[model samples]
Target chain A: MQGLFVVFRKELCDHFSSYRFVILFGLIAMVSFITSYMAGVHMKENLEALSKTRFSFLMLFSTPGALFSMVQFVSFFGPLIGLVLGFDSINRERAQGTLIKLVSQPIYRDAVINGKFLAGVATISILLVSIVLVISGFGLALVGVVPGIEEIWRLFIYLIISIFYISLWLGVSILFSILFKSIATSSLASVALWIFLSFFVTLGAEVAANAIAPMDRKKETKPEILIKNTRIKERVSLSSPMVLYSKATEIIINPMRKTTGSIVMMMPMEQILSSRFQNPLPLGQSVIIVFPHMTALIAITLICFAISYLVFIKQEIRT
Target chain B: MDADTIIQTVNLTKRYGKQVAVDDLNLSVKEGEIFGFLGPNGAGKTTTLLMLLGLSQPSEGSASLYGLDPLRKATEVKRLVGYLPENVGFYEDLDAIQSLEYVANLNGINKEEALGKIDKLLELVGLKNDARKKINAFSRGMRQRLGIAEVIIKDPKILFLDEPTLGLDPEGAIWFMDFIASLNRDRKITVLLSSHNLSQVQKISHRVGIMINGKMVADGSMESLAREKFGVGDKEYSLEEIYMEYFQEV
Candidate 1:
C-alpha cells in the first residue's frame, strides 16, 4: 500500500506538471462552457415563448430538454477526454526511457501499473466532475430555478454512471497504449477505435441488421413502423459505449408518467424527474447492468498492466 | 566464495535464436570489491548485467545475489542493489531533486531521510547547484551525475553500473571515477561496473573480467592478468593493448 501510494503520487505529479493534462483540461473546459452557454440560450427562449401559455414550470420537467442537451454534449466530449489521457500513458514512458528507472526500484512491477491506472482514472474523474459541477451551476443560475430532491438525485446518478462509461473507454485506450511501442502508433490506434465505436460501428450494425431482416418491398413503411424499427435499431446499436450512452440519455430525458389513450405519454412532472435521469434499472439491477461494463474496463486495464509488467521485468536496460 | 560473495552466477546463459548473448557463464564478485566487466559492444556485457540485476531472465542456469535467487527473489535482490542503466533517464519535466526524491520513495526510504540523502547525494555528485533545474535542460554530464545520485540514494549494498561515464567529457569521466573509487574505498560498497572504457575501469577496479564473444576469456587482477596473458614483465601494458592482443588471438 505504501509503495502504491508513492508511485501514485509521482504519477499524479507527472500528469499535473506535464502539458498533456493541461491541454486536456483546457479542451474539456472550453467545450463544456460552450455547451452550457448554448443550453442557457435555448432555455431562455423556451421560457420566454411559454410565459403567456397555461403551461406551468412542471411542463419543463416533462422533457428536461435542457438537461438532455447537456447529456448529449457530455457523451460526445467525455470519451475524447478519456482517449487523450490514456493513449500515451505507457508509450510515453517507454519513449522517455523512464521505464528502466522505474522497474529497477524495489517496488513490485504490478504496483507501477496499478498506480498509473488509478492516477489516470482519478485525473479523468476530477476533470469530469468539475465540468459537471460547473455546467450544473451555470444551468441553475441561468434558469433561476432549484431542482427538487428527486431531480437532483437523478442527476447525481447519471453523473456516476457516466464515469463508468468514460472509464471503459480510458481502459481501452490504456490497453492500446501498452500494446504499442510508439506514442504516435498508440494514439492513432486509440483514435481509430474511438471513431469506429462512436460512429461507424452503429452504422454498420444498422446496415447488417437491415440486410438480415429486409423491409417489405411492396408496401411503403408507415411512421409507426419506422419508429418501431428505430427502437429495435437503437437496442442493437447499444452494444457500443456511444450508443449505450445515447440510450441512457433517452431513458433519462423521457420517463414514463401517465398512460395515454394509445401511446403512454409521460406527465410533465414525471418527465422532469426522469429527465434528471437515474439509471434505468433499480439499484441492484443497475449494479448488474454496470458490472459487465466495469468488469470489462477493469479486465482490459489489468491485462495491459500485466503485459507491461512482464515486458518490463524481462526487458534488458540497454539504454 | 563463502558468505562474502555478493553476486554469483552458475552457467548463466542467454541466446537469441542461434546467436548467444551470454553463454555458459560462471562468475562471482566479493562483497566489497570493485569488479570490472569489460567487453566489446556486442560481446553480451549488458545481457550479463541485466541477468545479474534480475532485469532479464536466463534461458538456462541460475544467478543469486546475497544468497537470494535473482529470478525468484528479484524484488528482494532489487531492494539491496542500486542499478544505473547505460543511458539512464528520469521524467524529463522533473528537476534533479524531484527525480531523486521519487526514486528514494520507491525504494521505501523515509521522506525526511530521503530529503537529507538527496541533499547529500547532490552535494556528493557536485549537482547541488543544479538540483532544481529540469533534466531536459541538463547536459549529458549533468544527466549522468544525476543518474549516479539516483542509484546511490539508498546506499544499496551492491551497485550495478553499465557504462556510467559513456557520454561524459574527460573531466566528467575522471570526476565519476574518483567518486566511484571513493565510494568503494570509504563506504565498502560492492560495485559491478560494465564499461568499454578500459583505462577508467583498470584504474578503479580491484579485479577485471575481459569478455570476448560471450566468454570471459581473462579474469583476474589487472596486474596479474597483464603479467600472465600479455607478458608485462618490466614494462606496463595499457588495457587497450591487452584487449587488442586478446582479440587478435581469436
Candidate 2:
C-alpha cells in the first residue's frame, strides 16, 4: 500500500509535468469554454422567456452553440483526453527499460498498475473539475442566473457521469498499453477504438437496424417493424460507451429529459401538444431513467481495468 | 544448502510453451563472493537471473534468497537483493539526484536521509559533477555509474548485474569491473556478475558458473574446474577457455 502511494505520487507528478498534459488540457478547456460561452450568450438573448423556466442555468451545458452544445463536445472528444494520457502508460516504461527497474523494487506487482490507474483518474478528475468550474462561472456571469440547490446537484451529477465516461476510455487505453508491446500500436489502436465507438457506432447502429427491420417504401411499413427498427438501433447504439454516456449525461443535466428510450417512440402528435403542461421530473426521477446506463458504464470500466491488472501481474518483465 | 549461501535455486526450470528457457538446474552463490555468471546469448543467463529475482516464475522447482522463497516472499527477497539489468534505465526527464531519490523513496527511505545518501552515492560513482544533469544528457558510462548507485541505494545483501559493462570502452569496462570488486570488498555485497566478457568476469570473480542450453555445464573456482577437467597439476585455464570447451562439447 505504501508502494502504491509512492508510485501514484510519482506518476501524478509525471502527468502534471508532461507537455502533452498541458496541450490536452488547453485544447479541451478552450473548446469547452467557447461552447459554454456561446450557450450562455444564446440563453441571455432569449432571457425574457427562459427566465421563468426551472433549472435555466443548465442550458449552458445542454443548449447547442454553432455546432455542438458543451455536453455534445464532451461526449464526442473527451475520450481523446483519456486515450492520450494512458495509451502509452505501460509500454513506454517497458520501451525505456524503466519497467524492469520499477518492478524489481521491493513492491507488489499490482501496486504499479493500480497506482498508475489511480493517478490517471486523479488527473482526469482535476481536468474535469476545473473545466466545469470555469464553464459554470462563465454561465453565471453571462446568463445572470443563480442556480438553485437542485440545479447545482444536477451539474455535480453530470460531472460525475462525464468522469466515468472518460475514465472508461482511460481504462481501455491502459489495457491496450499492457496488451501491445509498441507505443505506436497501442496509441493507434486506442484512437481507432475511440473513433469506431463514438462516431462510427451510430452509423453501424443505423445499418444494423435497416438490416434487421428494413422499411420498404413500396408498401406501407408495419408499425411493429418501425418499432423494432427503433428498438434495434437503440440497443445497438447502447453498446458504445459514448452513446451510453451521452444519453446518461443529457438526462442528468436536463431534468426536463423524461426517458432514455427512443425519442421517436416517446413522442406522438397529441402527446407533444399536451406535454407542455407536464412538470419537469425531479432529480430522483432523472436518476432512475439513467441508472442502467450508469451501471453499464461503470461495469465496463471496471472490467477493462481488471483485465489489464491481471495481464500485467502475470506478465514477465523481461524487457 | 550451506548456511552461508545467500542465493540458491533447487532444480529451477522455466519453459516458454514448448521450448525450455531455463532447464532444471541447481545454482547458488555464497555471501560476500563475486560469482561470475557466464553464458552465450540464449543460454538462459538472463532467464535464470529473472527467476532468481522473482520477476519471472519458474515452471518447476524453487528458488530462495536468504531462505525466503522468492515467489512467495517476493517483496522480502527483493528488499534484500538489488538487480542492475543489461541496459538499466532511468526517467530521462529526471536528474541524477531526483532519479536516485525516487529509488530511495521506493525502498521506504525518508527524504532527508535519501538526499544525504544520494549526495555521497553520486560522489562514490564519480558523478558528483553531473548530479543535477538530466539522464537524457548522460553518456552510457555515466548512466551505468548512475545505475550502480541506483541498485545499491537500499544497501542490499546481494547484487545481480547483467552485462553491466556491455557498451563501455575497454578502459571504462575495466574501471567498472574494479569499482564492482571494490564494492564487494568494502561493503561485502555478494555479487552475481553475468557477462559475455569472459576476461572481465575472470578478472574479479572468485567462483564462476558457465551455463549452456538452459543448463549449468560447469560451476566452480577456476583452479578447481581446470584441475577436474584436465586432471593436470599446476595448469591454469582462463574462463574464456573453459567457456569455449563447454560450448564445443554442446
Per-prediction TM-score, please? 0.86, 0.98
| Candidate 2 per-residue lDDT over residues B14-120, each given as its tens digit | 99999998999899899999999988889999999899988999999998889998889999989999999988888999999999998998999999999999999
> What are the per-residue Cα lDDT tens digits for candidate 1 across A203-263?
9777865665555668976655555555556556755677666555434433332111113
Computed on alpha carbons, the lDDT of every model, listed in order, comes to 0.75, 0.91
Each predicted complex: what DockQ? 0.66, 0.88
Off by over 4 Å in 1: A44-68, A216-236, A252-319
* Native-to-model Cα distance after best TM-score fit, residue A45 in candidate 1, in Å: 4.6
Model 2 chain A poorest 10 in a row by lDDT: A269-278
Candidate 2 total steric clashes: 0
TM-score of chain B of each: 0.96, 0.98
> By DockQ, who's the top model here?
2
- Which candidate has the top score in TM-score? 2
Instruction: Flag clash pairs in model 2.
Output: none
For candidate 1, what is the DockQ-based docking class? medium
